[model samples]
Target: MSGSPAARASNATDHDAEQLRALGYSSNFDRSMSLWENFSLGFTYLSPVVGVYTLFGLCLAAGGPPMFWSYLLIGLGQLLVCLVFGEVVSQFPISGGVYPWARRLVGKRWAWMVGWVYAWALCATIAGVAIGAGPYLAAMLGFAPSSNANIYIALVLILLSTGLNLVGTKLLARVAMFGFLCELVGAILVGGYLLIFERHQQFSVLFDTFDININGSYLPAFLAASLAGLFQYYGFEACGDVAEETPNPGKRIPKAMRMTIYIGGAAAMFACLALILAVPDMAKVIAGEDTDPVSTILANAFGPVGSRLVMAVVMVSFISCVLSLQAAASRLLFAYARDEMIVGSSLLKRLSANQVPSIALIVSGVVPALIVCLGLFMADAVATIVGFAAIGIYVAFQLIVIGALIARAKGWRPSGQYTLGAWGLLVNIAALAYGLGAIVNMVWPRMPDAAWYINYSMILTTVVVMGAGLLYMLLAKPYDKGTAPAGDAWELSRSGSHATGRATSQGFQQAQ
Candidate 1:
């Protein structure tokens, strides 16, 4: 039986190789991504999702009028983390991102554990995007009441996203760029419309505090309220996942990371401010009474047609977000599989002729499909999945920040272009604090009859998922020694004599 299992593994590897050859990708597929394309893709990853106005109501529900302060705090915290990511990504611009950095900073064993955890985190994120995409699409179609229909709609969106990714990276990048443009235009229009027509609420209202009964503790209430706000800043480091495909990744990756942070951050803050000013009664909006705060605000400012237009724009933005996330998550899975960290490692590593991680893309699509199917068992599955996914992502973010701190302590700094200066230490400390706080808020237990039992499920599932990674490390540590460092493996594949493995354009050489 052992021999049979070994034979099956060999067959799988051979099949993966055959798929890569058919896809027209050389073994050095990692070198195909250009710096500009990488930056553009990264920008899209952070841009479209800035429309958190609809969900802002939930934050208000959690924290009352003081939710704005939570947004500011979370934004500042994420900026610190982004600074850390900028420093690390600029130094080691490999595809594995945190996993590779963790390996170099700590030891290979710890690195594998980090990589496995990070990969699963990204996988959960992709599932959340898929689940979220359904409702956004359903709203656009005017199907507001049917929960089951929305699940099917979400599954269809996931499938379509998979098809686009499987087609090629160039196509994916082009679509992402277009989506970025739509997000930019939509933000400007929405903000301007609100400013011109409905600028009544004072800025001071944002900082004003109000008390609520939340299991009898104000602090817990505040934390719960801030959790929703914190979710808005979750994907800033997404660019790091695609480092392998990025040209001059060392510089471009950091630039993209920082730009996304500042641009997306500023845009979201302004949009939220505009939203607050436009609404006459923030309390009514926060009480879970308004079904569509964004559309209502726009409709009040403009008209029914105007509201539809804004919804259309928001739908486009959500689509762009889904597309960008799908690409990022698939690449992450491909990177892990290339390192043989997963069960079907060889298959997951397959690349299309266009240098896209086609097999991984298909695998990612399957995950969301399964999650959508779970909707059949419960109406709140989407919310649960998203919360669980967010927890996974936050956990990975904490690990990466911890890894970055270790690297800094060891006097390992990336030279040239985006260094964090003397403030690197300070930024790391702030990021660590922010990450830990967010994790705590996300997992803090709620009352038995709370609206979201999914939060508890998320906490439990994240623990199990992470535990699986530890188990994998214990079982696979012996074989991992034979695999070359990610940097070296990338370099060898690019320089080798294989016809498809030759490097094309180059400015900054990869670490290998």
Candidate 2:
């Protein structure tokens, strides 16, 4: 393997392919996504612009300016989750983020349930982001932000993303990279301008709750407002979702995951802070009068033409987010189908001539579009769907964390390039606790006067998705259809080192 540089590179790729074969899967993806591209995919999925803009108004109205602090809290918690996930993906760089990781760590039935919950969560997220962008899209085009317009615009964005996804993986990576750059720059420029030129509120206003409380307590309001922060911190797991399309995934994917949290979290925090401090009328916004505070803030700070331009940037962030979410969801579907762990395995697993999961991508697009259509019947659809998405994602994540802890108790140790060593247990426990707390906060009934379904949407949606999955697993037993091997594919040595550690290390070095 120690020859010319080109020879070394070829050897590294060959080793990666061999490792996939060892896992009982064929390498059909392009494997052309570089480490930067991988990071970009996760970054754009997190999409600070989209998350902060969409949730800022709702959070402000629910819990006052202090709710912004949830960003830091959720960021720290999600970073711990990212660390545990880094360890898992390093050992098992499977295509689907949570599904294959759960399958290998636990068993078929458990993984199936996790995948089902996660896939629907991704769809809900896709629809949520697209719908969030509708207002901005309407602003850019000088159209009214009505329910029908939002639905139609959301569908258009989904269709556009699916078409881009069908083209190939390289283009996906490039577009993600472009989106990341645009979002980062836009956030910096817009936030910087607002902070320097349009700041009105004192810095101490963040600690002021404005006496917004529910049921003789502000706790519920703050917890409900936590949704804003929780939604911003996910999508880093998208790094692991495209493991098959990435080179040296065991080493690079972990780094990409961590970077996604650090960078994306910082950007989201800065942007949210800028918007919060620069709002033209905080009292009006918190009083539930300024429904679109993002637009209001931008208009006041940047004038009409500049606001529209920034709105266009926001639209890019949304579209990029949808693109990344669709990619992750389709990859999960492809992985499940590849393992024959879902219905319509043969069709969903098929790769086009371009080596992309075209049919699965279409399904991904179609499902989210349908979800967007459902928004037409519901008031505050973005908020409801976002709550559902956040809860489902947390539950799915906890399943993996729980599975890993169970595996560890049975004497399994992570032996990949990234290992938590003796701290794995503590970190895993912390991640699980944080995830569980977030889920509870997300599902807690807050809107007492609203419809029962709206008030309990988060809990209800989780029950429906998980209950449906459980029933399907019991009746269909789709996991029994695949011959794919499960459980740990890599062997550990007497000293607790991976048997393929040398090859993996060399491959990563060659890739470097």
Candidate closest to the true structure, highest TM-score: 2
Tens-digit lDDT string for candidate 2 (410-481): 677887788889998999999999998888777777767999988888887788889988998999889899
| Every candidate's lDDT | 0.65, 0.87
Clash count list over all predictions? 3, 0
Question: How many Å off is the CA of 199 in candidate 1?
Answer: 3.1
Clashing residue pairs in candidate 1 (N, C-alpha, C atoms within 3 angstroms)? 23-353, 24-353, 34-247
In model 1, which runs have C-alpha deviations exceeding 4 angstroms? 1-27, 30-37, 47-51, 210-220, 380-382, 446-455, 476-482, 486-512
Candidate 1, poorest ten consecutive residues by summed lDDT? 499-508
Local lDDT at 6 for model 2: 77
Candidate 1 local lDDT, 1-512, one digit each (tens): 33475564444334333323422322444344455456556666555344365466666666666666666778788888888888766655555567656654565666676666666665556666555555555555666736677677677777878888787867776777777677777887888778887886877776655556566766666777776567777565767777655544556677877777667777777777777677767667666687566666766886766666776777666666767777877877776676666677778888778778888888777876777777778656555655666777678778878877766665554443477778878889999998898888778876567655443787777777778777767876632743635322222223442221212111112211
